[model samples]
Target: MIKILLVGCNGKMGTMISTVAQNSTTLTIAAGFDSKTEGNFNYPVYDSLTNVKENVDVVLDFSRPATLDSICEFVLNRKIPVVFCTTGYSAEQLNKIQGLSAEVPVFHSANMSIGINIVNNILKTISNTLYKDFDIEIIEKHHNQKVDAPSGTALLLANTIKDSIEAETEFNYGREGIAKREHKEIGIHAIRGGNIIGDHEVIFAGKGEVIEIKHSAISREVFAVGALKACEYVYDKTPGMYSMDNVVNDTIKF
Candidate 1:
């Protein structure tokens, strides 16, 4: 059985993952860390990673990027495997995560829904194969509490699509009063609303036709399963950077 230390244990995703862990005989919650947890679970509750023992097989994070440095330090110092499902990291922070991958296994995914990731893969392949035939645009809707615009997942889709297009060029976050769509520019729009779980859509437009591919997540538990899957994937792997793409065992489209 794999033991998990869950970060952000007071949040919705954390609670969902806990329930999932409780149901699975192959997994257990070793400990949880949260700034706002009201009380204890069956296991320990910690407010600081420094106070927590590195006794678990894996650490799963769904917290803010602000907490990343401390978490990375904990993982590196403890030599523990990690699955980071949080979004909103700067490029330098991402590089830092990659840096630690040289010493300990790490998996990070903006979207932890396996089916959504598979859709991203297919979008990459199609964009690469049909660059001239399509004009690409992405729109993502997330919960109101989400801070980032043009969600990490939407960017993942757009970036994957860009990777496939040979002459792929620019990423346009949104359009204004008088803008023209460049053939190479991929458009991304972000929507935040009340109680929305998650929704993503990729539009492929051409002179004569249009195609749209979409994915909607109804529950946070899907991401929990994905995080758990990442734990399983990186358990025996070398210390290196990985994404859900790697966990899903699909070739990088580009």
Candidate 2:
């Protein structure tokens, strides 16, 4: 069995992951790290990684970016692989994550849904074929409680399209005042309200028509399931950085 040390175990995603692992045959929760340590769980929940009492094969992180420093130190010292499902990290924190990848297996992604990963791949193909004649715009919607705008999945889609076209594409996040759309710019818009799980739409607009590619997440299970798959993949991987694409290729077909 692969023993997973789940960070942010008391939060929504953490609880969801633990609930899923209860019926898992190959994966088990060995320990958890969270600020809220008062809870009834099959495994022990520590106030921090430094307080964990059991050995674990891997770490699954859904914690805040503020705790990243401590997380890096804990994993580096133990030589353990980690899957980061948290979003809204600054550029400096992202660089720190890249630096840690040189010493231990580090998996990070803007979105963990396998469906979204497949959408990323499809967008690449579509962007390459239509970018010359079409203006690309992305619309992403999430629950009001979500902390970040443009959703990480929106950026993932934008970057995927940017990579495929091999052009100097600038992202314009919601316009202000009066300005015409730039040819090489990708417009990204965000909507936050109600209890939307996730919804992303990429539109290709031309002179007379438009084409849209979309993916919608109905629940948090998709993310939890993807994180488990990432844990399984990174358990024995060599020191390096990985993404959802790597996990998808090894575990399932597009």
Candidate 3:
């Protein structure tokens, strides 16, 4: 069994992951770390990781970026693998995560949904073909409670297109001011409303046709399930950085 130290255990995603783990034969929540320590959990919840006593094989984090330093310190000291499911980390914090990967297994993904990762792969395959002729635009929708604008998944897809085409591309977030659209600019739009699980749409507009690829999450459980898959993938691996792409490649044949 993989014993996980779940960070942000009181949050929605944390609770979902816990519920999912309860049905898994190979997974268990050994302990939890959250500022709000009191909860209706089968496992003990501590206000800090330093207070955790249970032996854990991995750390699954869905907490805010503000907790990254403490989490990094804990994982480094323990030499345990960690899966980061939180979004909105700054470049410096992301660099810190990359640095941590050199010492222990670190899995990070902006959107931990299997379908999203597959879409990411598909973008890579088609970006080279459509980028030169097509004007790309990405639209992402999430719940009103979401703090980050232009969800990480949107940026991920934009970056995928940029990298695949091997060209300099600029991102335009929600255009205004009546400027003509630049040929090399990719448009990104964000929508916030009531209880949207998650939605992402990519528009590739060409001379005569527009190709739109979209992924809409029906429930938050998709992310929880993907994060758990990431947990299993990184559990016994050597020290390195991993992503949902790696997990998808390992599990999906085509």
What is the clash tally of candidate 1? 1
**Per-residue lDDT tens digits of candidate 1, residues 34-137?**
99868547788899999996488889998899999999999888787999998999999999998989999998888988888889778766887667888888
- Distance from true location, Cα of 23 in model 2, Å: 1.3
Candidate 3 RMSD to the real structure: 0.9
Per-candidate local distance difference test: 0.86, 0.91, 0.93
Q: Estimate each model's TM-score.
A: 0.95, 0.96, 0.98
For candidate 1, list the clashing residue pairs, or say none. Answer: 128-164
For all candidates, the clash counts are 1, 0, 0
Model 2 lDDT at residue 209 = 96
Candidate 1 at 138: error in angstroms?
A: 0.4
Which stretches in model 1 have alpha-carbon errors above 4 Å? 250-254
lDDT, candidate 1, residue 133? 80
lDDT of 1 at 222: 92
Model 1: lDDT to the true structure? 0.86
Give the Å shift of residue 123 in candidate 3: 0.4
